[model samples]
Target chain A: MPAELLDGTKTANEILGKIRSQVAVRVAGGGSKPTLATVLVGADPASITYTRMKRKRCESVGMRSLKVELPAETTTEQLLAEIEKLGNDPGVHGILLQHPCPPHIDERAAFEAIPTAKDVDGVTLGSFADMWFGLGGFDSCTPGGIMRLLRAYDLPLSGKRAVVIGRSAILGKPMAGLLLAADATVTICHSRTPDVAAAVREADVVVAAVGRAEFVKGDWIKPGAVVADAGYNAGNVGDVEHAAAAERAAWITPVPGGVGPMTIATLLEQTLVAAERDA
Target chain B: MPAELLDGTKTANEILGKIRSQVAVRVAGGGSKPTLATVLVGADPASITYTRMKRKRCESVGMRSLKVELPAETTTEQLLAEIEKLGNDPGVHGILLQHPCPPHIDERAAFEAIPTAKDVDGVTLGSFADMWFGLGGFDSCTPGGIMRLLRAYDLPLSGKRAVVIGRSAILGKPMAGLLLAADATVTICHSRTPDVAAAVREADVVVAAVGRAEFVKGDWIKPGAVVADAGYNAGNVGDVEHAAAAERAAWITPVPGGVGPMTIATLLEQTLVAAERDA
Candidate 1:
């Protein structure tokens, strides 16, 4: 039998429904609605679209969105100043700096400016440490969403062998940390990794976050393994070869409606959490 | 032929010599000497010995030591207040909080209170993230010592498979991060790991940080691999069966004069760096 689709869109909708109801209860209790501040540093079309989708998601859940748009030529110092302003703003319960700020800008420096209290995007170093140590801090959206998806499917992670392909700070690295915290034996494979196929073959859970089109081949997956493809490549392609992988894997995520929708949903959910904590 | 020993005593003495000269230069240049403040919450005998060794090491290198001793009944808030004082004190360049601070006190909270600027012990969440991301920051002492050992021996790590048998924040987790940053494929195993021996068998580099005597068997080590035993179990036994491992491994660290001395050396080096930054 082919793999059961993880159905991220359905899971995302369910989450959003819960978030909407929670927002209603808070508002009915005379609590101020949660607010998410998003800063976009460049005019990259994909980034623009992502920021718009995130803003739209915030509005759909009855949360306020504060969008700060900057030109492509913005300096790193200017970007840091803007983020610092949002971090200090009393109205901003959560802060999100859209990734892939223009070249020549120190992205890490910008992310560090967002204080842990309001770092809903979970991009700061403090949040990363907390996530890795299982200390209940906010996690990066896509990895956090993947965990939620795994929990929703009732997939047992403890004592499982997990292979995380890619080591990007936002996705791959934290994904491994989360899996490790879940008691999974995690092996992080990157471009320099000598035997990616061998590693994936031994994995009970394979997380592909390499941002390449169908980079993880079907044959590499173990039969009945859970495959989470977090990459959103240029042509709507996921990191895993979906149809082929489905033939062998027991469960797999689809590209467009899978991890992508969940990322935005997690962002909104974490923003609600930050707001609640602030309240 | 048996594996060559990685001499931590010689390396530490060399480092101390360099630090002494550096301190002399800084003092002659009219810069203030570095100061490390150690906070011991309880009167645990082992903790007292460790703190004393750290302080003596600081003084031997021409650094000032500020010792803060508290009773076993000290509350978490009281400890946090003490750490806050040290963090804010301009004279303090580094802060070290001896671990195992009574069962009732929240140790993580106390460690978090030490500001990142003075966290030469590298116990803070910020330092962990910085170490993992390869952003030049203070590293946890034991792991930093292990890294220095690896570098001193000119052991090439790129494309190597390293299995770290423990997940303690200070030793195993940060050790894996340091190795990963050096381009090694890293796997972290802990008590919950189903097959520790199997993981060790596949590793080109095995770092045993689990606090158990001879926990990592000699047969598990791959022949000609590099073995770093970080455990300091009672009776001077290491996590790896050192003699047996040395017979098979190409390079190995002996228990007494190995990783232990390097820890103090790194703490002193990081304190010097912190002081220089402050100056």
Candidate 2:
């Protein structure tokens, strides 16, 4: 049987439609429009493109977008000051900082500067702690998207064995925390792990977040396992070698059509949620 | 083969003795005496005794102690302010707010007030993030103590399958994070977990922190498994039912002497470390 795809694009659209109606109600009530402040450091083309796309999405959903761009040579102190400015601004409900700032800039420090209440991107220490501690609030967009996808499928997360490959701050680690909060037995593996495939073979659910292209072979999957490929390689390849994994996975997400679209959709949904909370 | 005991009282004394000399050096060099601040709310006899014990330990090492006691009726705002004062105080290198602060108080908010830099107790959001992310300056004392006990015995951690039975903010969850950081495949189990004994049986290392006396059975432990019990039930019992487990485990910590003293020792050790880092 072919693996059933978790269509992120369709799911995202469904969420966006709901958000549109909610935004209309708030506007009709004469409430201030939900405002998201986007902060981009330096002129990285990819960051610029992503920021523009997010802003476009916000506009389409009847939300306000505020974009702030900074020079490549900006110091941490300066960037922090800018973030503080947005944090205090009455008009802004959420702040999203395009990450991977210049190596010299302390990105974590920069992320920390965003007020916890306004951290729509959920990159602050407070947000990370809430996610890790299972206390609730916003989550990293992509991982949040994966949770949404799982919930949509009506899958049982409680008491399942979930093996997460990779431990990056933004995705893998947070994803593992989310799964654990859902009562899943979570195992985190990385490059230093002696045998990743063996770990994967025992998983009821496998979440692949390691950045390598097609790193997880199809033969590694347990039969009837739910496979989530959160990895996106340069040519649209995922951590899971799709062909082989498709044969074994009862449910699988494709790299391009799967996790990618869901990331931005979750971001928008959470931004609206934060706006409501703030309002 | 009979299980070897992991002695905490002896190990804690050894660590404290080392810290004492270092503190002496700092005093001789005309540096300010290292300080540990304890914010105790109300007169819980148990909390009082624990704080006093911690203060006595600090004094033995030539460190200064600052005590802040509040009434049981203290507001969340009042407690938060006290913690914030300690966090910002340069004289307070370490801060420990006695846990189980009056039930009405927002314990997490109080914990949040202590800055990561002075969170020698490792209960704050900042410290938790650092601990989980593995870029650690401080860790929760109990878990750190457990790690120390394991390392002292030359127990192998990397790539081992570890099961942590408990998911409290201070103990089990952080314990799993520490093990994961050490490259162990960590599984965190809570009361909601199903087949906990089965999960425990598969572990190379099992840490019982559920606070229930004798909850972990002998049959749950794998042959030659390493076990760390951080439970301190009333009347000197521990989370792991000791007698039968001793027969199965390769190494196991006894209840009273196993993890209690190590936790107190780790607090002092980390306090001194925080002081030196500040110096």
Candidate 3:
């Protein structure tokens, strides 16, 4: 059977709708406005676009957005100080550092500096560990969104075998952690894995986040398995071979409309959550 | 061919020897003795034995060990306050909270109370995340010992498929993270895993940490696989069926002398490391 589309676009819209309603309710009740503050360390084109989109989503949900842009040559200490400022701001409930700071920047150091309370983007190790242990903490955006999509479609996760490709801290590692938290027996395959196809064949759910377009072939996917293609490459492709995978997968997320939209949606949702928590 | 034994006792002795020499050299150079402070929240028999063994190991290596026994009725806040005092002491290089604090007390909060600089036991989420990212943080004891044994035996890990059966914070989860960091394709199978045996059958390396005696049957082991039985159930029985598994495995860690000794050894080694870093 051809796979059903996991409509990330529709699901994301539903999430945004809920956030918008909540924001309106809070405002009516005279509660403080929800706000997400984003820090952009360098003017990378992709990052600039991403931050703008995220901010637009915040506005769409009736929350405030703050943009802090720094020059490309900013030092790690300087970047940390900037994030610290957002963390200390009484009105900024959530903080995000646009991904992929310039090569010279100490990105990890900056990510660690964001206080756990305001870490809406969930880049901090404390949040990652909490995600693993099923303690309530913000999830890393991409993985968190992927979990939401899976739940939106009512996919079975408990006791199922899940294979997650790639182990990047933000995406793959947290993806595996989230799946495990959902009671999935998760195998994390990476570049060093000798037999990714074999692993995928056994997986009931496959998450392709290796960032290589079409790196995961369609045939390797188990029949009727759910596939979440999280990689966004140039030319509007994803980590999996979309057409072929769709033929075999029970449900598959399309590259352009799938995980891409949910990242921002999850970010906005978490920002609202932080704001509510602060209030 | 019968599997070769991964001699945990001998390896642990070797590690202790190294730590002992380092401790002696530091003292000879007019440095203060490395001190490890252990907090015992309640008098569980197992906890007492474990702490005693660990502290004795410290003494065997010429390091100072302090044991803090709190009443079983200790509140989370009270325990945290006690831990904070130890954390603040300049004389204490490392602090370990003996595992399984009385159920009424919040264990996670207590574990988090141990400062990162002094968390040689690696129970803190920060340390676990650091282990995942290879960020030079202290490793959780049992998993750290398992990794050392693997390295000592010169077993092939990179590109190998490892199945860790359990997902407890101290053992299974960290084991999978360490294996992944070592470039192994890692699978974490827990009680919720429907086919733990099937997962084990495909593993290049199997770590039995589910805490159930002989839970991982011998037939589940892949031929030529390396097995590290991290479970120490009652009556000297491990999670793996020893005789049956050892017959088919290429390498294995025997129960009593295996991962057991390595845990205390790694703890002492990490304590010395913390001391050195402090120095």
Give each model a TM-score. Answer: 0.97, 0.93, 0.99
Ranking 1 against 2 by DockQ, winner: 1
lDDT of 3 at A52: 93
Ranking by TM-score: 3, 1, 2
Question: By TM-score, who's the top model here?
Answer: 3
Per-residue lDDT over A1-279 for candidate 3, one digit per residue giving the tens place of the 0 to 100 score: 799999899999999999999999999999988988889987888889989998988998899999899999899988988888888899899999988988888889999999988888999998999899998999999999999999999999999999999999999999999999999999999999988999999999999999999999999989999999998999999999999999999999988999988988899899888988888
Supply DockQ values for each candidate. 0.76, 0.63, 0.95
Candidate 2 local lDDT, A156-274, one digit each (tens):
88989899999888898889889988988887888777788888998889999998999999999999999999998888899999989999999999879898878888888888887
Model 1: per-residue Cα lDDT over A49-136, one tens digit each: 9899999999999999999999989999999999999888888999999989888899999999998988888888888999889998
Best by DockQ: 3
Regarding lDDT, does 1 or 3 come out ahead?
3
Q: Which residue pairs collide, candidate 3?
A: none
**Fraction of native contacts (fnat) of each candidate:** 0.69, 0.62, 1.00
Which lDDT value does model 3 have at A218? 92
| Model 1 chain B poorest 10 in a row by lDDT | B190-199
Q: Which rank order by lDDT, best down to worst? A: 3, 1, 2
**Full-model lDDT for every candidate:** 0.92, 0.88, 0.93
Per-residue lDDT, model 2, residue A9, is: 82
